[model samples]
Target: MPVSLWAMEPMMPLADMPAMVLTPARVSQPQSEAPASVTVIDRNLIEASGARELYEVLKLVPGMTAIKVDGNVPTVAYHGTQARDSRRMLVLLDGRSQYQPGLSRVNWNDMPVDIRDVERIEVTRGPAAAAYGANAFTAVVNIITRDPRDISKHTVSVRGGNNGILDGRAAAVGHGDNTAWRASVSRRADDGYDEPFEGETRPDRKRIETLNTEWVWESDSHNTFALQVGGSQSRLERQQESGVADIGRYTREPVQKGERAFLGLEWQHVFSATHQLKISTYGQYNKEVTDFGVCYLDPFTGQQGPGGALLFSQELRELYSQNGGDTAATFAAVPTSGPVLSRYGSLQGVAGVNFCADSELDLQEERYDLEVQDTWQINDRMRLVSGANVRHDRVSSQAYLSGTEDNVSYRLFGNLAVDVLSPLTLNLGGYWERDQINGEHFSPRGGVSWRVAPGHTLRYVYSRAVRTPDIYEDQAITNIQALDMSEPFASNPEALLGWSPSYFFITQSSPGTLKPEKIRSEEIGYYGQFRFLELDVRYFQEELTDLLSHALNPFEFEPNNEGWVKHQGTEAQLTFRPTVNHLLRLTGAHIHTHTNKKTETRIAARDSGSALWAWQLASQWGVSTAYYFANDYNDYRYERADLQIRFRHRAGPAELEWRAVIQHALNKEPIVFEENQYQEDRMWLELEMKI
Candidate 1:
């Protein structure tokens, strides 16, 4: 294939490169001088990879795991602790948090910004509590978008491909003497995987719309102000089953709708060469609604019952009838039947008769945050960065919580850096935080970086991080309301009249409130830049305690902090660029975990690696290929390859670019979410024009 001339764009020289990190220290420091391990993915790599989604780009980061259970639902795990609701890591969009307090999960499908608007992504692959308070237990991801000044003209993009994928986006930027503004709108839809697991329904289908706008004003070099606003709406198809006994049936084609909006303002001022200050405020609102329904059979007679009713055993039904709706006695009575009732029954039952009640888990949350920070250059060798913030969260849910709940939190953090000697630097940082639900706690971090040689640097770091219990875990109220049996069995009172007329509630609450999960970590890292290669290697060990897990008592299933886990890992990344048009990148990680509970081991991969090759055949065309592999785990194992080809041309006043990407080129099927779904090969083509 012939490559385009643009594909031969010169790479930035390593010597002149400045520190591009943002999340590690909340300050721009040279990559070699940063205390923590950081990975930066720039726009050039993003464009060359031909990736259409944000999660796909994260695969390049060492020790980071990106799992897409379906097209619309994706989870990213750092340091080997993943779950259905991943809450250990914090994600930020241009410094604004995307974490939802109600669910404690990041809704990747509903993010306001499209992939085309993103300029770079910074990932800190370790505990970040010292910089960002609680919930930064494992790692942090910060996404930075292109500034108005960086957008030279208007652009439009359109993409279409297999599996019903279609996407469209339009962006425009305007500049003035003292101000600049940017606005963008995007719409995307995909059919997802065509084939679902046997007896299961397809879940990856999705449609989403988003809008984003930003304005900035630079009065002078001393002062600057910026404002940003974004909103998104998404509709996704999911397959979920009920957890209730005898009622666990697959819900095919269940649709979930989400709406989100955010507004932010930032101001910075330079008092002098020695002192600078910045203040930022942001507010976010999100609401999700899904019509979740299930079907079940009556436990006693093994006959299909009403779709939405909560049915009990024959003995409990008789007890309720005799006791006149006494929930205590009704629950105390044990089943005398020989066989145990199955939570998930066969799907062959009749529809209307086996239909359970129509229920919905509707969650709505609002958050407001304000923070101010100062950067002081104490002297030529010493610097200090300090900040404090206040946050308030309001959550309302019908299925998860009692009612509207309010949580207020406050945090104070500071970091000090000192150059003790010519080639050695020391950093110390800590954060103190207090919240209405979790009380008060403190986390600390310390590190030292040494320039062992002209091209090599070594770093040793120690840190502690915490993960606070989320709203659902701390105050969940699972209500199972029984349907009225009076009318159905009025003719035969003895058979059905004994059933309870009220609801059965399963509530999880702790008298002392659950303690936050805590982890202490120690790491040693080496970074080196050679004539044709750049290498980064790190070894880390972490001890985690007070982890949250469900109580073992059969009578109740509340959450408790009674888990201990230890993890040790080694990760490395190697980038070899022999010439301007040829490049090779290799990344690998090996992790071992010991846990008091056996289930935790399934969350992380034991070994994983990827090898990528890119080449510019000619000026107008380019090609890239990659192979990714992961050791077999309990749930899944995969080895897949990908290919991308790009073409570019000039059309009068507009520039046109086209790219085609093939994922899972070998057509391998990978199981995800306990074999409920399988990921299949896919192909997509994108065309973009800039004027």
Candidate 2:
């Protein structure tokens, strides 16, 4: 039977921040209703934007700040917290977690699913750890792909962008009685951008490719079986800003590669009109290898610090020496002869110690889950929906430097919704999850929506969420040079202040003791849409406890349950479709957040906000302009604003697009300047084709 026939109530397609009403009377309703802050990026929108990579399209989404720290190295900031990694947001590709086990970062290159194969992307811009598990403190992104029934033909496309970027995408679908199959593949390559910090420009090359295939079969009765397989590989070569003086004139090195493969199978069975069950299983493998030639600078003549500190200091010394002044070291070259002291002072040698650091990580994971959901209609005036899911995840990771660790995680979740009146609906959801890392949590959520008028809706929500510590948070092992020694031994500037003579110490600790973080949220909002115009507005407040942040002075990050950080914000969006071919969209947000020590009255105040305006002239032409403004809370190094513009045009299956942006658009001089790190303006462009 057709899937649509399975709906006993109206059903709305999953959307981002929408109040769309489903065709009521569907047997199996969506597990959760769309929140007012959710944003849906469908395939149509992806194609219209002419984005060549995930970062380009994701940047427009509210509450997310994306920047290229260096060519080929993109950093993500969500909810005012930025990280060199991109794992804060939970990203799911067809219900499979895209995060590396135990690590709180995401590898964008592994996200190779072609836009052509995507049906829609659902974004929930709030803590979603309750529904999606770890690394969802800020939001959730669910990428739902095209079902076999929705893709019934063969299609192919090719694309090209500035900087030698090239791409090819293809998909094919076929069907036999009661069965359907679809396959898709995408390949993309780009020369990338120049390393930003230094005067020398090095090659920024990147390549990514993916393949996915799916098979679905419907039995004569009420049963269905589906199987899916997907894999991706990427190779990148880029310059490390600090290492720009390593080899000859450029510190550029080839990042050998990163790869991932996944396989999944799902089975659904319906015993009767109001009873159904679903079973899903999947396994994944991922690997990464980086060959950064001289990736870590030797500390003999450089400041003793992490892999990064030594490089920066050496580069500076080189730059000064090249100007014909007294030179200690220069970006041009490292000295061949010098007294070298081991970080621990146990080993001593002359210069040219020749130390090379290589890192490799491998991960394997398997997951199994079962869910049962149904809607029972008591009458036209009343109905109830409920469902429950049980899932188990087993994960293991091995790294050349960090060694290996294994863990198992499990969760049980359910949701309830009821129609209390002709125009009012009430919803409640709860879940219990446990991980081998010693974190177990129970989360509950509740909300209501009322239709006060024919075209207007009002809603309010209050939810509780929890985040289990991540793998990295639980078991990460790394080596760093200690700068501030508070113990009996400490030193800097090649001088006094410690028992140890003239050096930094290597600190090590077990990472599995950190506790979980928890959050409580409260929100109330309203939305309505006129025939041609729509407006949505919302206000929300959230509080977090046991937040974990790393500190070098203390040498170890102890859970700071001693404070509660609060985030309160207002969001508004206006959209208008004057004609079938014209669209105008405006979105803006203002957030006020304060962090305080629970034991003290002191507060850290941060004010951050952003606004975006986009105009779609037609299905083939579009343009967008956006501006962001933020204030510093604790330091001047993190404060700035930016202006951005994007343009897209599609002509005969071909698309052209460009993004011109200026970070620190106001050119506000850094109040506290660090020699190697400073804010600067940049420009980016991309262009694509479909056949």
User: All candidates' TM-scores?
Assistant: 0.89, 0.72
- What lDDT score is found at residue 55 in candidate 1? 77
After superposing candidate 2 on the true structure, give the runs of residues whose Cα lies further than 4 Å from its correct spot.
1-36, 73-78, 85-87, 133-135, 202-204, 238-256, 271-275, 295-401, 479-507, 551-564, 596-691
Q: What are the Cα lDDT values of the candidates? A: 0.75, 0.53
Clashes of each: 16, 21
Error of 2 at 308 (Å): 17
Q: List model 1 lDDT by residue over 223-303, tens digit each.
A: 999999999999988755334434445333468999999999999999998899999999999999776544545544455
Candidate 2, 1-691: lDDT as tens digits: 1111112123332132244322111123331233335655655555444445666556546555544444565555456442343444667777777766645556666775766677677666676554555556667667778899766546666655445657787778898899999998889886655323346445557888999888999986889999989899988775443323432122235475777788888887876665566667777777665544333343443432232323223233333335433233332343421311122232222233322332223444445555544455545544454455555555454331145565566666555567778778776666677667765777766778787876677877777666565655566543322233222222232322122222112223344566676777777776666777666677889887776644311123343335456778877666665543344455556677666642211112244344444454444335544454434423432344444344545466554444444434353433221221333443344333323
